[model samples]
Target: MNLKKLLVLVLVMHSDAGIAQNLDTPSIKETSGYTLANLSIDSQITMFYYTDITPAVHFYGDILGLEKTLDWSWVVFFQTGSSSFIGLVTEGHDAFHDVQPSNAVMLSLVTNDLDLWYERLRQWNEVTFLKSISDSGPIRSFMVEDPGGYTVEFFQWLTPTE
Candidate 1:
């Protein structure tokens, strides 16, 4: 048998030689520091900057139906019922960001209502297609451009996440 399969069989049999290695090394917290390693992260947000944030806000909030968690004159935060968030920010004096609108960021939304979202967004005037709805064995998905020119994808897992 191959080395990997043999090792797997040996481990399955609980052989002494197959015991896990015991290494004495500094913990990951040592490098990252106690504060960061122990930080209670509530949400992860992918932010996009735009000269005009209104259209992007409507796309994510109105069309996608994500709940608004925070809103200000220059920024808005939306949550997808989890610790992950999406922030839309205006690229001007209020937020102190002067960067150009970026298309490098892609927002991926996982959902059970794939068809519902596809139908809803396809009807929106701001929707621009990047990819048509299609299946790839493990997932059914489609991609489109949001008002800010960022790629947005909606996907449904054909099978439960492994």
Candidate 2:
């Protein structure tokens, strides 16, 4: 079987076990005929460029309460969720050079406690509140701007009867 097939088989077996598997250390028998290269595309990390990372750190870490996983001076990584990370690259860095910040993309976060987040963020004078708490369709949401001028939306999904 090809590498992809082998990986699928292993994943299927683990899934059938009905237990959470540690992605850092996948259990695979050598007899399965799969190598490390076959599972190279393990996880993905999303990144955003910034002219300065200090504000990014303050916004994501201090304000949003995301854990700072890595700090590489020019590049910093924040743990956004399980197996998900957001990287901040400083301007003049190869990855951020010539790139302009745009409102075309917004980082959205879904939460069960929208009111709590709103209360907390409102207390911070640095937070730029674009929209107040409002219910629209099936979601209750609000918008804020980070120091980098990026729009961040916080929302909670409303139940059918709500």
lDDT of each: 0.75, 0.75
- In the range 44-161, model 2's lDDT, one tens digit per residue, is 5777778788988989999889999999898889886677788888888577454474645566677898999999999999899989999865668899988777778888767769
Q: How far is candidate 2 from the true structure (C-alpha RMSD, Å)?
A: 9.5
Q: Candidate 2 — what's its lDDT?
A: 0.75
TM-score of each: 0.71, 0.69
TM-score, cand. 1: 0.71
